[model samples]
Target: MLDANLKTQLQGYLTRLQQPIELVAALDDGAKSAEVRELLDEIVALSDKITLREDPTGSARKPSFVVQRVGQPMGIRFAGIPLGHEFTSLVLALLQAGGHPPKVDADVIEQIKALPGKYAFEVFISLSCHNCPDVVQALNLMAVLNPNVSTTMIDGALFQNEVEDRQIMGVPAVYLNGELFGQGRMTIEEIIAKLDTGAAARDAEKISAKEAFDVLVVGGGPAGSAAAIYAARKGIRTGVLAERFGGQVMDTLGIENFISVKATEGPKLAMALEEHVKEYGVDIMNLQRASALVPVDGGIEVKLENGAVVKSKTVVLATGARWRNMNVPGEAEFRTKGVAYCPHCDGPLFRGKRVAVIGGGNSGVEAAIDLAGIVAHVTLLEFDSQLRADAVLQKKLRSLPNVDIIVSAQTTEVTGTDKVNGLKYKDRVSGEEKRIELEGIFVQIGLVPNTDWLKGTVNLSPRGEIEVDAKGQTSLPGVFAAGDCTTVPYKQIIIAMGEGSKASLSAFDHLIRTSAA
Candidate 1:
C-alpha cells in the first residue's frame, strides 16, 4: 500500500526500534481486511524487529489491528486503514510500541505511569480531519506509557453503525469507559489535566513562583509566537502564556497563501512556529487562559483561570480570534451533535446525509463545495442579497448539482431532539419561514477577537477588538496588542507576524524610555 519513497521513509523510521514488536490483526474475510493484511505485510517487511500475526478472535471489531511489544498486553488499536492524516499516528504507534522513547516531557511521562485507575479510551475519527491525529496520538502515548490505559482509534466513516449508535456527529469524538469524554482537538497535557484533577493546582503553584518577565506575550498563535521570538532575540526575558499554543490555527486545514511557502497544513505550520520560538530563550506556558489583567507597581499582572498570576514589565496581547457562533437557540446544545464549524473535519461524518451551510462568504461557499462531494445535498444560505465569495468560488459552487443557494436568508434556530435533524431560517425578501431537513449544520460566518478578558483594562473598539496606535501601543502604557485581537485591518498570517514584530519593538522602546526616566 506504501509507495517507493514512503517505503524508504518507513524503513528509516523502523530502524530505530529497540525491541521486538508484533502487529496482531483480528480481521474477517473481507476486502478491507485484505487491504489491512497487505498493509501489515508491507510494514513488517521494513524491519526485522517487526512481525505480523493473524488472530481473527483477538477483537470483536473486524479488520482491526493491535500494536504492542511482543510479550506485552494489548494497548493501541486501529480499526480502519490508518492513512491520510492518521498515517503519522500509525507510524508513531509502531515506533513507540517497538520501544522507541517518545519526546514527551519527563514529568508527563511520570504522571501517566502513576495514574491509579484504568482508562479505556475510544476515539471516533474521520480521515480528513486534521485535528484527529493529535487526540489519537495522545491517547496512544498514554496507553503505551501505562499498562492500565488502553486506546482504540475507530474510523467513523468505516464503522458507520458505531458512529450512529453513539450519536457521534463530529470528528475526534473521545469516549472514556464507553461514556462521552470530549470532542475536539486535545493535547497530551490537556488530557492529563482532565484526568488528574490536582494537576491544575500544581501547575498554578509552579506558575506563581516564576520570576517576572521582561516581555510577556499572551496567546500562542502566529502573532504570539512572533512577538515572543522578537522579544527574546532582544536579550529580554520573554514568556508566552497561551490557552492553547497555535490557537484557532490548529483547527485550520489548508494554507496556500502563507507568503514564500507555496502550500502547507495548519498543524504543520504551527509546529514550525513552536520549534522556531523554542530556538530562543523564551519561556512558553501552554494551556493557560488569561482571566484578567491587573496593573501592578511597574508591571502588569495577568491572572490565569487557575488562579495563577504572572507579572511582566511589558505585555503584548496577541490572543487571536476564534470561529464566530450563530448564537441561535439549540446551537450551543447541539455543538458536537450536528452543529460544526469545520467542514474538512466533520464533513465525512455526514456523508450521504443532507446538510446546510450558513453564510455567503468564501468559507461558506468553499464548505458547500467540499460537502457537496461527500453529503447527499448542501443548502447554502446567505443573509445578504448575494454571495460575498470570490467569483471563482461562486462559479464552482454554482456548478455543483447537489448544492442549493438561497439569498437573503437568515438562520433562526437549529432543530433536533437527540442530534441535528433540521434547521429553521427566515426568507428576508419574501418574509417567510422555512425549514430544511438536514443531519448537519456548518456555520461559516466569521471570527470574534479573544479580547473579552481585557474589557475594563484597556481601550476596546465597539467590536471588542483591542484599540492600538500605529506603533502597536494600546491605551495602557507599556501594553501593546496585535493580530486579530487588535484593530489591525487584515487578519492574514503574514500580517499578524509583522504586527507582532512591530508590537515587540514598540514594547522594548517603551521599556527603555521609561527606565531612563
Candidate 2:
C-alpha cells in the first residue's frame, strides 16, 4: 500500500474533492486483488466524500476498479495497479471524477463534451513507461468530461495474456471500440484532432488569421521555449508553432545533466518549460507542423500542412531531432509490431523476451544495461569495432549475464513474419552473415535532424543539419536555427536552451540593424 508520507500527501489531495465519488472494484481473491482492496480501503479512509464498493460482476478484468461520481456510470477504470508513472493519472482521475475542475482549456472541455459518438478507449501501458501517463491521463480527463467517452488503463505487465492475444509489442498501445487505434506517445490535442476530423482545418484557418510576429519560433522543444521567452522579454510580439511541445524531451525519461537541478523527469521538465513560457505575452500554438518555409516580400511565410500560412518577421528553427531509424528491410513494416525506438517507453512490453540493441554508444549500452534487468537477453550490435560508450557503462554492460555484444556488425535486415522474430547482421571481421532470434529490436543508433522541410530554403550540412554562424544565424538573413537541428556540437537540453537564447538575441539585433538602415 501507500507509505505514511504518501498517505499524508494523498489525504491532502483528497481535500480537493467537491463531490462524492465511488471506487467500485472488480477484484478476485488473488494477491493483486488483495493489494487492490487494501489500496482502496486506504484511499477511502482519507476522504469522507469517497466510498468503496466491491462489484465482482462489474468488469471481466480481475483486480480492476472503476472511478466515478456517486450514482453515475463508470467513466474511468484501472485494470491494474496505478503506481509509478501512472500514479499521477490515478490522482487526477479521482479529482476529476469528484467534480474538481481540470486544468484543460475551456474550449477543449467544450469540444470533448460535444463529441457525437460513444468512444470506449482502452490503452495498454506499463508502469515504468514515462510516456504512458500522458495518454492515460488525457483519456481519463476525456472520460470525466464527456459521458459518451469511457476509458480503461490496462497495465500490460499484469495482463500478459491480453497483451499476447492482442499482439501488443509496445507500451501505450491504444484501442478504440475493440480495434487498434494507435501505438506510441500522443497528446490530448493530437488525440482530439484524430477523433474530430474537422479540427485540423479549423485550426489551420485560425492560424492563417493571426498577425505577423516579431520573432516566431518553430518547434516547441527546449530551444524553441528559450527563444520564445527571450523574444517576449524584449517587449516584442512573439509566437511559437510546434507539432507538439516538448519535442523529443517528452519521450525522454531520466534527465540528470540539466544544470542547477539535481534530477528531473522529461515530462516534468517539459511542463515547467511550458508554464514558464506561458507567463509571458507569447502566443503559444501547438499541434501545428511546418510544411515549407518561404521567404516572402517583407518576412518569411511558413506554410502549414493544412494549406494555411503564418508570416513572421524573423523565425527561429528549433524543430529538433528524431530517433534515427535503421532503414533496413522489415523495420518500417513491423514498427510497433516488434520494432521500437524509446527503450524507456516501450521496454516493458518486451519483458522476459529476447531483444537486440542496435548501437554501441552510451544510449545503446545504457539501454542494454536497463533491459537486462527486465528482458530475458540482450544482443548489442555495434558498427564500430570498439564501443563508444563511457568506460563505466561498458563495464556494467559486460557484467550482465544475459547480454551479448557484437563488434563491427552491420544490421542487414529485420526478419519476421507478422511480427519481429529475429534479425540478420554481417560481421566485418569474418565477412560472414549471421542471424539472432529476438522478439524485439531497440534502435538506439543516434538522431537525425528534423531539417528536411527546410532543406532547399536553408543551407544544410552534409549530414542534413542546418549550418549556423557563431551568432546562431542561418544562411538566410533574419532566419536562425538552434538546438539539435543545427550544427551545434552537443545536443544537450541546456546547450539547446543557451543556443536558443543566443539565436533570439541575434534575430533581435538583425532587426535593429535592418530598421536603422
Candidate 3:
C-alpha cells in the first residue's frame, strides 16, 4: 500500500531506509492507524526480510550511513527529508523515534520554544562534507517541527555565483536573523542559542562581484567540462571553477576504456577536454572554492572562499568525486614520492621495482594488472578475505605473472623517511605482522565525494551524496546539481558527463522561464 508515486519521486534517494527492528518489538499487535499507517505497517513488515550489504562494491549497494575516520561506514536512519530549520528538527524527530540526540542545554531549549511560528531560513551544503549532511538533516527536521521555518538547499557546485556573493568559505553555514551563525558541527541547542542571540545572519547586497551571468558550473572533471561545453555551445554564458585545471582524471595515469580513445593518460585527457571547453569561451577559474549564497530579489548572490562574489540567475553544480585518502602517517608525506594514491599516475615510475596496491577492488586489481605489465612485482592487499571486484577482472589479475593477491591483509603502518621504502601490514586471520619492501604504494582504498565545502547549504544523502530529482533539480529553486556528487549508481566518467549535461539543460530551462517571466 505504499505510494508508488512518492517512491518514484524519491527513486534517486541515495540510501535505503533501514528500519530498526526494535520499532516493532514493542508493538505487540496493539498499535493501530488508518490506511496511511497500514502502509507503514506493510513497509515495516517487508523490512524484516531486508539486510544491508557489508560491501558497496556490488550493484544496488547501500550508502554509508556515517563517515568514519578509517573510511568504514556510519549506520543511522531519519524517516523524513531535510530542508531549512527542519534540519534541526531531525534531531527532535529522531529523539522521539528512540535515538540519542546530540546533547542540548535546558536554557537553549527554552529559547527554541520561545520562537514565533513565522520566520524564513535557508541552509546551503556540499555532499563531500562528512558532517554537512547531518547538519542539513538537522536543519530540515527543525523546519518540519516548526511551521514558521522554510529551508532550501543551495548546492555549492551548482550555485557558485550565489556562493561567491555571500563571502562564504565553509559548509553548513546558517544565516539567521540577518547575521551569520555557526559553520561546522552544531547541536540543536547550539543553533538555538545562536538564533536567540541574534547571530549568524547577513544583509543582502553586502557581497560584491554583482556581474550577471547565465550559467556557472563548479568542478573541472569530465562532468564539469561537459556542462561547460554544452552550455557554451547553446549560446549560454558559461564559467567553470576548479581546484585545478583538470579534475580526478588529471590524477588518473591511463584510461584505455574511454570511447574513441585506445590509450590515454588522465592528465592528457583532462587537457584535451579543457582545451575544447576553453575554445568555446567558457570562463575558467582554477583553485577556487565557493563559500556562501544569499537569496536576493532578482537572483542569488554567491560568495567564494577567497572572498570574491558573483550573482547569477541559474547555477549548475558539477564538483565531481575526489580520491579517498589513506589516513596513514607516511601516506600523505610520500603521496608523489613513494606513497601514491593512483596507480595510473605513478605506475611507470616503479618500473622494475616492487610495488604495493592497497586495495583489492576493481580499481586496485586493475591498477595491479596495469602495474604488473610495467613493474617486476605487484602486491595487491585486501582487508577482506576475498576481492570485491568482477570475476573477469579477478581472473585477469590472477593471470598476471607478477601480481600477488594477499587476502585479509590490512596496512597497519607506512614506514618511510622521505620516499616510501616499505609498508608494515597486519594479517587479519593470523595476527602476524610483516614489513613488505616496495618502491611505490597505491592507495585505492575508496573515494570521498568533493563536498566538504558544501555544508549548511544543500541537501545531501546520508552518504554525502547530493540529492537531486530525476531531472537533476537540487533543493533550491534556481539551482541544479549532477555528476558524482549526486546519488547515482555507476560512477563512470561518461555517466557523470551525462548527468552534468542534464543539469545544465535543467538550469537553462529555469533560466528561460525566469527570463520569460
Q: Each prediction's TM-score against the native?
A: 0.99, 0.99, 0.55
What is the alpha-carbon lDDT of model 1 when measured against the actual structure? Answer: 0.94
RMSD of each candidate relative to the true structure = 0.8, 0.7, 25.0
Instruction: List model 1 lDDT by residue over 400-488, tens digit each.
Output: 99999999998999999999999999999999999999989999999999998999999999999999999999999889988999999
**Model 3 poorest 10 in a row by lDDT:** 60-69
Cα displacement (angstroms), candidate 3, residue 41, comes to 83
lDDT of 2 at 223: 99
Per-residue CA lDDT of candidate 2, range 321-349, in tens?
A: 99999999999999998999888878888
Q: Which residue segments of model 2 deviate by more than 4 Å?
A: none
Count of backbone collisions in candidate 2? 0
lDDT pick, better of 1 and 2: 1
C-alpha lDDT score of every prediction, in listed order: 0.94, 0.93, 0.62
How does model 2 fare in lDDT? 0.93
> Where is the poorest 10-residue window by lDDT in model 1?
245-254
The prediction achieving the highest lDDT against the true structure is: 1
For TM-score, candidate 1 versus 3, the one ahead is 1
